[model samples]
Target: MRRHRSSREIAAAVFFAGLACATLGGMGQRCLPVAVVGHLCVDLAPRLREAAVLEPGRLFDVGPLGVSLGGCVANTGSRLLELGVDAHLAATVGDDDLAEVVRAAALRSFGERVTLDVEPGAGTSYSVVVEPPGQDRTFWHHSGANDAFTGGTLPPGDVVHVGYPSLLPGLLAKDGTPLLDLLRRASARGSTTSLDLAVVDEKSAAGQRDWADLFARVLPLVDVLSPSLDDLLSALRIDPGTTPRLDLADELAGRLLGWGAAVAVVSAGAEGLVVRTAGRERLERAGSALAPRAEAWAGRRFRRPVIAPRRIVSTNGAGDAATAGLLAAVAAGADPETAALVAVTVAATVIAGDRVTPTLLEDLVTPAPTTPSAPGDPAAGAAPSAPLLLPANQPRGRFYRGGAAIGAFRGTGAAEEFTPEDWVGSVTCVRGEPGIGETSLPDGVRLRDAVAADPEGWLGAAHVAAFGADTKLLVKLLDAGQRLPVHAHPHDDFAQTHCGTAHGKAEAWYILSPGEVWLGLARDLDAETLGRLVTEQDIDTLLGAMHRIPVAAGDRVYVPPGVLHAIGQGILLAEVQEPEDLSILLEWRDFELDGATDGHLDLGFPLALSAVEHSARSREQVEALLTRADDPGPGLPVAAEEYFRLDRHDVRGSAELEAGFAILVVTEGPLEIGGVPAPAGSTLLVAAAAGGLTVRGNGELLACRPPVAR
Candidate 1:
């Protein structure tokens, strides 16, 4: 039987296979000829330690310094070569020390494919990159010889990519006349023409020009126009202050299409790439590269979320890398969706301090074929196990408000208001909502199905022996946009006896944002009063009954079954819970949800109210439920061991972790877990087969796992 494949895998295969075709014409031994033109510079990057601070007249300690090639020709052209494409670089530099550095870097990678125009007496461009730990990099750039670079002769190639027009003042001068001329020449040669723009200083002369007018004149000849959202916004003089990023991308892409570009791609950092293409007629004129599939490429609109990198070193050349990937895919005749995926994947590898190797690209997009086990065998198709990257599974039309925080955290673009909870590696569905909260892998296989196929591989032999195929763990990224209604969940015994469920909901939260939480009752109340509170919906008195405690990032709070609690508003948290979702709503006023109908797990409020913990608890008792960020091991309370387990690791140099079936969440910094680059705000699922993982680099990670087998 054939193995199931994801659209991503198919796209990757199609892209690479198309590159291998001889119909596109080859350069030397390499297919898919691409020409990368525009800014070239030397980058001097100084890495900083966590303790290092940037202050005037104050020197701080630093890590190793790195000298590398920067700008479009260096970043994009080199990436194209790495992806097995023949990329010829056409860029200008000066006869200076920095020029030598640029030459060495370029020649070392591209060899004869590099063409450098050395301007006499002119200085080569350079950038001083001030990159701090766990922060975006700041560049102090000098556009030296780049300013002297007029439109050069087009390199002979199937696709010509001109980049960083904002940095090349020569092109931006005369209202982008030189750029238009170059694109026109490339188009006339029947070559695909692509353009990329750099971030421009608002006060610079290039930024002061009428960019809208310039693009209007130049875009007609350009086949592909890809620019960073910020740069596009700046060029169009659009203030997207509070507009959602996806919406903004749509608007920008519309304008670019209106300006006559064959395709418009907005590289929205974190949100990934937003691509919109022109009609069939316009796409037909795009160039020889896209001519084969112009019909499939026309009038398509989609957004590709940024693929989480193994780790993020620096985002310096990511945009350029993405442009290279897009151009490569276009040269190979890939459909728009496949092309976007390829672009994002390539950019991810760039950020992870690595380039996309053919093998790595295949591993990322292709699903491994597995031999089917004997009939009736549960452990059927889970072999050659590796870590699976889980995308954010935020369900929509939820009762709560807020998902924008989750979207921001996951870099998946703006989420709807009701999608406040992100279910990660989830096998359990919402109570009474089958298939609602269960997570589906990128390959379209359900986590439940994968676990079922190879229980021993996914859950370990010992775990499967003890708990069958049950994961018993449900992880979530929760954003309380508004104060949650006071509620409580039934204990296992109560659930089994009344609700007929296998397990009750015993959950814990690892705070990611600061806020207050109500847990347990401050004073004792009779069952009649608690029942009356639910019956009468007395919101004030019910909330006053519980102890309100403050929480901050890294703090862990354990909520035992039957404990009445409510998560406060303006707080974002990572939650680990039992595999069931059963809550007894005690208060639900002022919320959009019809609590009277849906809040009580369908058992009716009268029966569900019996599960509430009405006993009075002292301040000390309530405080014991919380654990500080600096708490030793296993952030959650010991009581939580019966349900799930969570361990917080503050890795500095290196740490070795025992192999297990676990979900690793990188909370801060860039680090490698089991040879995977795990950047901050990324989640990775480590299988039992990935044994003895070693964590390198500085970062904070939370390892969430199922409880030990009995």
Candidate 2:
């Protein structure tokens, strides 16, 4: 998909794009890149009026005829590169004038990374597509050089996608021997094989072949198979137009997976996309070269309609663009759900216009090389810089269960469960400001007062100079014994207008234990719907609008202010955020809190939802917010850096941290600071005057600090 940028923005973007291009160029041309190999065609699409009539052999004036790249290699492959994916195209085109046009476009768009086989005397495939408003499209198609693509020398990559195999006559010959041979060869060549289908003419040699038999043979070697509902029906020798759309797609997807295809993507034109992954056992064995990514794919099935684009226009290459998105994300190592979201979001752009300006899905992309480390023994690395280890400063909350996690850290009694959240070095508190839910330290020595007494000793001199003796950050060790309610936090503007507060809670999560969480709106939720849901206490309706994301230990989640979110059951996490507790809860049933009374922060439902973001965030956008649970170094998402800062200290022998007033949560390993043994399961304080704590032993800790002023 292309990105539309204004002149000034485009010029500025090109600088970064140039940098990205240069970096990607430095990598091997085929390294971890998506290799698209299949049919090549050019589509001539003419838009007709809603009431336009056409007679046989009649030519009339058309509204607008758009000429653009067509077929698998160009549509999907080219779009992949446009979306910032490392992709190389390999397709066969005829030795003709149209071939030169295709070749030039390919070379210009993809640079020298394109691999096209210009066969002398071969016909370049072309299609005359008639798109009339309020009517289905009819195609006058010719499969020329595409029919000659009989699994030619494919490029080397982790994943290889072969599109329109059904349109390639030579590949479908001999009971699909050619296609099987191609897939097998591609697999053996150290590449995971993917397949996409094309609409075949009923009378063509390609359609007359035994597709049912061919699918059995070819699917076993294919790792990913994506076909439209009609295409799947054609393969099954059934009329898809007469069958229920999602049912038929699901049926065919299941059959394809059963036939040993590790993943199945069923496209229902205009309706949406359904993706299913094989079982774990199958993923382990049938994933072929893609097994390393199986954990991200196995045993998942999700269907999503296209995300709404900024505008509605010709849907030419929407599916291909979406496929490009999936492949691009998968190639970049995103999980299945995240990849599917990227697909829908990308496709949304295709439907919206010729180019896509990225919104939410752009967050899924991080530089590939600095990938976070997989979860491991945290104590086996370098120590963080901070020196002092204070005791857990947990304040009681009705729904928190940090006692177990904190107990596990301190090696105390059988670690009874308590809903104690870590609130270290904080200058802000909801109850303290209201003089309710307030507690003091031993002998009425409040932690807030203690910090104020020695601002330079606890908070750094810089922190005191910048914002006075108060620390601006608050951290929590939250154990979600039950799912939290759907809720949102106001932003600074909203809080200032509604709550008389200086800051709003824009929180981020660093998962200490793996589980699921609900984040943002899965669909564009209108204020009426959200307000009604909250007023009526329609829990399902409220939650159904949100995206449920599965997370793992060490994952990072960025929750911007005004975005609705909920912590799922059985998740233990360290939450860092701006120092406030102004929550506007949407779903509070079956929990200890009273929705009618306490859920809305004393503000009525009508006014509270104003603090909620009503915009639609497709599943892809929500998944994009979850970082791949790999990075070990202070892995807070960049989106959250402005609200708060986090550092993951993997201590081996020693390490140094920047001098600051911060809360420390020890996640793993055995370690000590300033001769005090702070093992796993402690939330302590570090004095800024400590001037960077030096770790002496092996352990892992998280340092949570406030936002740096602009």
Candidate 3:
């Protein structure tokens, strides 16, 4: 549920931040931006060998000291930007020389994107990190100005991240209200939020506090909660290295999830990490601000092995690297499995290096390893497909609470079953593939590879040549159980220039049920007004500005990028888009989101507001955009043909479907396609090579395919 800004968008935001754009300059042009709130301190590490003994009164000889900007502010924030996230930073620093060094490092790393509040005369906080070779390091830390960072004032972003509450006393005391209030504000503004923790010192003020009461009050406000094992153990006051420590960690993580965290991850050194999720319920709680896909996280319960670094240097900041990587992946629409692996891999890279640098962080942003073979391939130990039936990939999404519409298509009766089972979406996605929105094959086979192994058969030879083995389309059975937030997606140009991605979201919908919806703007509004209303959290004004439309069964709506829209509750539709799950939320109030922190995509309001189409639409414009189902014959309007296409076939007696890489959703039927016995509510992937597959039985189906150009 904790939505993260895409590394691409985050990097773009950082690009502007690094530039220190004075007035939303470059940021106004980007997508989702990320903001990190925490302590920006100096880390002075002095190395010592394990054999060295501490002398009570003697000044022992140690190696040369390594000085750099430490703490999550510099560590995580810098890495996220370096990894190409459009991100910014906010932290409190003392007005000392060390603060200047912190300032220099931050500016040099991310420019004005990082906001450092200098407390006059107060010395910057510092840490004396003592790392004895092969031994756990000890930290002698000074809270300094960091003790006062309660997120009192935060820069704008689509996702807001905070860390080291133990190091921020004012942020943690009184049941962490100040920090919690900030998080609530961020969610109200529609930002997906994340929280990180630091190891607590047994002798410090933090160690003396009652953690049990504090976490219960704060954890639920966070979408993503990642904490180190040491921190969790110390706060819970559990004996160290118990007989069943790993088991205890899992139990602890589950408790936090129960406390309200959507996704709970605990980092255990050497043993790696354990992640838990409540699936459907959690995704629903995240709301539409994040556009979270259910299958990517819901029902995901897994453990990952540590990616050992090439060698051990200092372990400091490695945890931050891990956290940054996972969030980046999540923001980029990468699956949960990929996110965890990337996190561990980045941590490994950090540990293996002498120090974290831009060059090193770049390596952390590489593509994840692809699957070896298609799922269910004989070599993979999964059963082979039975004739015309391909695996029915139905994954839940965070946008809705249940997928009754999707479930009905899959033959799951009246019970609106939703969870690991939410929406039946995607088949050979062209974009955001092998990352997020990809389908798994039989027995763990990946859809990408399955098609790659036989491109001509799966996708047409033309599609393979024009768009490679990947299908240039994505199809989904969307059930709007609730009204989606007023939002818009970026265009290809906007994405390339601001988000650094090849594709932007250009989608169309084929309504399967009746519901009210909002689209486009009723009248042109000045950019300043739009930005002001957004900043002021004027939900009524913003929603009223858009064109409201009443849609019913068989309505075909074309949703171009950069246009504001909201799918009214109770409408079920077959949705198709550019494959990437990228949305810029405009209204988050009354929804489960932090509009102030997440609505702007980290580029600030001015820049993000510019991407929206503020031009007024006439009644004709509205009518042209909406094509009644009765007027069309199995295809979308001209505005959408360039992106994707859809066709509805009501089968009865005998019918044959043309061959092409297509997804067939049984809207209403008890029929067979290409020899596959598909009943009503079943989804099947039909290969182009299947040529004109013979169909038998009476049924209705929605046939989906990529754009004509591909």
Candidate number with greatest lDDT: 1
In model 1, residue pairs whose N, Cα or C atoms come closer than 3 Å (at least 3 residues apart or on different chains), thus clashing, are: 310-677, 310-678, 311-677
Against the unseen true structure, what C-alpha lDDT does each candidate score? 0.78, 0.68, 0.69
Tell me the spans in candidate 1 whose CA falls farther than 4 Å from its real position.
Answer: 1-384
Q: After superposition, how far is residue 332 of candidate 3 from its true place, in Å?
A: 0.7
TM-score of 3: 0.49
Model 3, 5-40: lDDT tens digits are 457757765655553333123223222456788877
1-710, model 1: which lDDT tens digit per residue?
A: 01234576576556645644432333222234687888889899887786345589986777788899888988998787676666677788999898888888876676656778888899999999887777788888999999987656445567888888989988877777777767755654346789899877888887798888887888888888999999988776788999998889888999999998999999889977799999977975676676535667888998889899988778889898888777776765567887788789889888998857643333222211222334322224462255555656677567768887875665433455677887888888876668888876532356789788877777888998999988888899999988988988899999888878788899999999999999999998888888888778998998888899999898999999989999999999999998887878777677666677876777877778778887988999888888887777656888888899999988999998777788777788678777755557678777676677889999888999999998
Error of 3 at 11 (Å): 14
Which stretches of model 2 miss by more than 4 angstroms? 1-31, 50-59, 240-243, 285-289, 357-361, 365-710
User: RMSD per prediction, one decimal?
Assistant: 21.8, 24.5, 16.6
**Highest TM-score model number:** 1
